[model samples]
Target: MIRSAYSHPVAEVEITELSAVPLNVVELLSKAHHPKAGAVVLFSGEVRNNNNGKEVAYLDYEAHQIMAAKMIRTILDDANKKWPLNIAIAQHRTGKVTVGETAVVVITASAHRSEAYQANQYIIDRIKHEALIWKCEYFTDGSHQWGGNCSCH
Candidate 1:
């Protein structure tokens, strides 16, 4: 279903467990933010259980607040410049998150699905590779390893 046009711009930043998200991401972008929006792509990053056959018990993410925020904003800005994204929001979780919890959410709105998909992938990749964030993977054996570094076993 298409959303009604949104006239007033909405807030676009949050970084806590109780943070408010644009519940109507697709609608907000299509009807309110960009009247010409035809495609909307949303992605969420959740804590996973399997990593190299080892069951992950939990995850603790740490970040250099100042730098991480700056980097995330930079990623959004870069994506907007490179693509036809009308409204984009990308957020991550910090502190501790249990398995299956949503850790990150990225939404991209564009006139075409290509832009939406490309920008969505670009944002996720850039944040993981360039942002000042670190993830500690807690395994079933009570051992931990740093992630966000190649994502390879």
Candidate 2:
């Protein structure tokens, strides 16, 4: 998941993960809703218990706030240039999160379904790959490993 704490004008993206995800993603989509916006796309990333052969106890996501927000905004800018988007909202959780919890959410509103679809994919992909977020897996065996810190996982 990506770290939250961003404020932008193009997108009203207030994110909180302090007591688990506090807002509804559907609500965020509704904010982007408009008569002209015919389509809205949403994505949710959840915590899992297992990765590969190891049992994951939980996950710790860390990020540089300024850099992450900048990267996300940049990705959104690029996506809007390619897709006719009306509004976009993306959020990812940080700190320790357990199983079955929501770790991230992305919502994209557009004039057409195609634009929403492509923009949704682009936003999530860019956020996961370039948002300066690092995830450490706390294993059931009391061991831990990190991912998304470097090119080599």
Measured by lDDT, the strongest candidate is 2
Q: Global lDDT of each model?
A: 0.69, 0.71
**54: Cα error in model 2, Å:** 1.8
lDDT of 1: 0.69
Worst 10 residues of 1 by lDDT: 1-10
Candidate 2 yields a Cα-based lDDT of 0.71
lDDT of 2 by residue, 1-153 (tens): 222233322444454322234336667566667566788888888878888788889888888877776777677667767776767777777788887777777888877898899899988888888788788988999999889223434
TM-score of each: 0.77, 0.80
Pairs of residues clashing in candidate 2: none
